[model samples]
Target: MPPARSDDDTDGTRAALGTAPIEPPVAAWPAVGTPADGLTEETGQAKKPRTAAFGFIFVTVALDMLSVGVFVPVLPRLVAEFMGGDAVASAAMYGLFGTAFALMQFFFSPLQGALSDRFGRRPVILVSNVGVGLDYVLMALAPNLWWLFVGRVISGVASATAATAFAYIADVTEPDQRAARFGMLGAGFGIGFVLGPALGGIAGGIDPRLPFWIAAGLSLLNALYGYFVLPESLSREKRAPFSLKRANPLGALVLLRSQPQLMSFAVVQFLSQLAHLVLPTVGVLYLTFRYGWDTTTIGFTMAAFGCAAVIVQGGLIGPGVKKFGERAAVLGGFACGIVGLSMQAAAFQGWMFWLAIPATSLWGFANAANNSLMSRRLGPSEQGRLQGANACLQGIAGLIGPLLFSQVYALALAAPGTFPGPGAPFLVAASLLVAALVLSVRATRRPG
Candidate 1:
């Protein structure tokens, strides 16, 4: 019992039942010009919802950092367990562990960057998450120092996600928006540290190995989430062929040389990174040996530090930059770092140590500002390369910081009369921050 075949009825039927229009193939989509910040441009088909992408990236980074924070509070105690209560030997071995991680990062970071450039960001990031999960599992099962070292090596090789993640941000965000966005990214780190160390401390109190298993579980879950939701940011047409020449870590540094200003900024970056490394390398040990702090106390202190970071990086950085400009923010950040380091070095009372957290959190502003400034100077195609170079510098700092600070700490503990104090390493770090501040000031004075 169909309706009568009027023209209107026929038209309505066609509208309701006719085949839906087909979307253009991804290859056939028109390419759009992105902002002239030399970062990645989006094509029609490649453009997805950016807010979702940013959220995913933020969460992923937070989780990655969280796992790190969870283990840090227990790392020194775990080492002590293996070394028969010899603080000096434990400190020395901790340095070796850090060195192993850094060595792997130095060699592999550029390769990951280059791979992201060719294949895609999603696959590399997913793989990294999986690797980190497995590494944590290995560490959880480790019965001795050698096995622990193996875990660190694996983790380091898998930790190139940061650089690639930065490149992903560069691909999606406009130049003017990058600073604020980067600040938010820093916030993700802060939040991770906030939850990770605090929980790790509590969990470590129950059983030091429990946090590792928990961290592994979280990482594996992250990988699974990413496999389903993460989208490709780089388009095939914009991707460059991977080359061993560009993939070499030493060769990656050469790219910075091509931009003289970037080279100066790189040095500034290096000094800051080097100064910051003293904390994770020696913070737990120093607190344990000097202040006689337990795992829970160290974790809470780290959480406090993380809270400060969240406040500054998440809430204050954008306004600070808007009010003072990027250069001034960099200078101010370094100044805060010097003050904080000095406080930590001289802190005789436990409360004095807690007071330094907010001041040191301001140091993160320099990182976001400096990175945003340098990122703007390059084109889209170069974002991965630039991030890779920065990763190399961080790797170098990681390699040197633990060795220097751990040795200094051990030496101070071993011969309290001969050396200044266990805080000698903090003083050294403060000096490095001073150098970084001077360089940052000098770089700002130059004509662009």
Candidate 2:
């Protein structure tokens, strides 16, 4: 028999007609485990575990990240091509592009969150996927840098996936189950980075626009997959009405503040996120300038980091959190970040730089830790808003991180008398982590 759709509205209509039990929808795949014995009494039917739904969300996240990753290697060069290959001018323009993208995310992500609250996660995610695909198409066909810029801005506005996806995870998973799932979400990021750049670089070597075309196809395909397979995690009773006032980015931050220790947790997330931006923003340039590494070598390093991330986030987080608890995991992750960034700052030898990858990869624990901790503070109705507010925080970090890292690195290079030299940015990033660790300690000490 065909599995019924799991839209919350449809769930009611079908139940009234005396159809199947009220379990979340999954595609008609083979069942793995026995029907859950735990929820049987309350639900009045044998319920398949919703981990299958979690699988769908995982694929959604991985594909979204892959699509975004496909363009990363080529974007600055594309901007440079528009600048007549003027490196300095292209650098400034690239920073502007990053800022503008973040600006759009800052303004729109809260609206996306509120919409998910009013409607449901599935529609919001579908819209985001379609928008991303369309945006890639626009970029691929762009005739000028400004046109590409517009495409980027649209992509930012379409950035609903992170907030909604996280909220969806929260809705389906139990409190104890959340950290591991969040780690899996982070693993999706690792998978994207591992595959996206290699594909992008190869395609880009043939034609700069080809990767964007590929990205477009991937996104559209993902949207189609979601349309057929993705179930609504949010139910009608749990959804809150959408509010423009609530959707305001500042208002979202206020929401974080209203909850106990939530603002402090936000601060910890912001600093850690900001610190982590060093790799993507200026990592390649730093390696070239300091270690005299070639593109192939840099690519391998990135792949190694990605693999390590997958191991740590996908495989290790659940066990580590289970044994040590979320608070210890949070602090330990920060500790790893501090040491890792410091290693990068001080590494004069190539092998020394490589060692930092595993250390830094373990820092993935901090992200899941913070997310799991914060989600517990909000009601199910407010989960979307909480994720939305966190999106705004990411936007803020995105706005600042790229520029900050670039300037610090650039000044380190040009200023001969300045100490720390090319390693200055890494040092600065490490310091940010140090601060984050201290704040996290205080945060973990307080009651929710």
Candidate 3:
């Protein structure tokens, strides 16, 4: 095992690796001709601006998530509409939609990341935003299942925006500041979730197709706003040539493996992402089966979950990281996940189910901390590639997660007396999370 890295050794590690120091001296940060110059000027933060480029990216992420959330409340019914109202068939078809999206993301994420590295963050992001807007419009106008599937494919291809967004964040922020910034980003997602589902449910209640139009409008507006205000974070000198070998998903994973410190964290990220799929895959079905929750009730529950996430990621992550360090934060967050999943699995009543939401929100701490850890290990030029690889990993997990959990849930439902109840998927999630926790602990303990 390599020796553990201390905070004090950060600069030394960067210097020894011949990489730019992760945290340059404050005086050097705003120096003319430095990479930070554009960021500083844009934010008017001679020091750290109150709201810098990251703030815009944060809003971009929030809006992106909001568009996604708006669709959630009505997707099942939409699927059922095409499937002749067979709930089981609709559920199966919905999993396929999710899988198609993930499959496209898996193939394209690294390509998008590599493109961002070569071209620039701004164009890639803007294009993705435009694509998402079109996708929403397409979904809204879909006349049949084929059209819906086409729309999903387009949406999946455009989903590469997330990887580019993370790469943008890494370009502008220092390593030590990354976790907090990522926490803020996660908070944006939380806020989006809070507003999107609730509003979507209301709109969906009135007209099932209304939310998609609204979502499409939001995506277009977001794209227009970004075109005017978003600045390029990657300096020309830092740009790398794009290569097909580096752009493929398998190639991306291989590139990730080239970094010893990143491999374990990547695996942990994969497992955690897979485990999280339980929420989207089985969450609605489980609730409906177990508690007879309707769309409105499920929307409210998701909003509440988003609220808890907002509180924890926005409010607690920075302090939690400061108090216990990234490793501890990661471990503690995973611990919370274990507890939350277990509680969710055992909860028989609605109130008991609600209680688990806040507990699971702690998982955001782990996500932000792990991202920070990984970001710090790479050089500026490598950020896009790394993030893209991570995105591909996430894509793979997303592809597998829904299918796995849905199958498990279906099987469990079919044999309720032999298996756990609707909450059986949570038990499976808890088990995966346990493995992730163990891997995280071991990985963090190892020296870089």
| Candidate 3 per-residue C-alpha lDDT over 1-448 given as tens digits, one digit per residue, 9 for 90 to 100 | 9999796686465445433212323432334433423234455443442364666688778876786677777988899999999989898898788778778888888988889989989899889888888888999999998898899888878866778888887777656667777898889988987888777888999988888888888778878887778888887877888899988998888877875657888988888889988998888888888889997788779778888999999899987776456777788888999899989988989889999988899988888988887876666666778888998888888778877999989888888677577788999999998998998877776335
Candidates' TM-scores?
0.80, 0.86, 0.84
Error of 1 at 297 (Å): 3.6
Residues 1-448 of candidate 2 have per-residue lDDT tens digits of 9776666755465345433121212322112221111123344453443665677678767876676677778998999999999999999998788788778878887888888889998899988888888988999999998899999888878855788888888776655457788999999988988998888888999999999888888888878877877877766866888888998898788888875577888899889889989998899998997889999999999899999999999999988876556777788898998899999988988899998988899899988988887776666777888888998988888878988999999889898656898889999999999899998778776334
Q: What C-alpha lDDT values do all the predictions have?
A: 0.79, 0.80, 0.80
Deviation in Å, model 1, residue 111 alpha carbon: 1.3
| Candidate 3 regions with alpha-carbon error over 4 angstroms | 1-52, 75-93, 143-145, 292-295, 411-422, 446-448
Total clashes for model 3: 2
State in Å the error of residue 424, model 1.
3.8
What stretches of model 1 exceed 4 Å from their correct place?
Answer: 1-32, 35-49, 73-95, 137-149, 204-209, 285-296, 407-423, 446-448
Which regions of candidate 2 fall more than 4 Å away from where they truly are? 1-52, 83-88, 414-419, 446-448
Candidate 3, residue 73: lDDT: 75
lDDT of 2: 0.80
TM-score of 3: 0.84
**RMSD vs true structure, all candidates:** 12.7, 10.0, 6.5
C-alpha lDDT (0 to 100) for residue 265 of candidate 3: 84
**The 10-residue segment with the lowest total lDDT in model 1:** 19-28
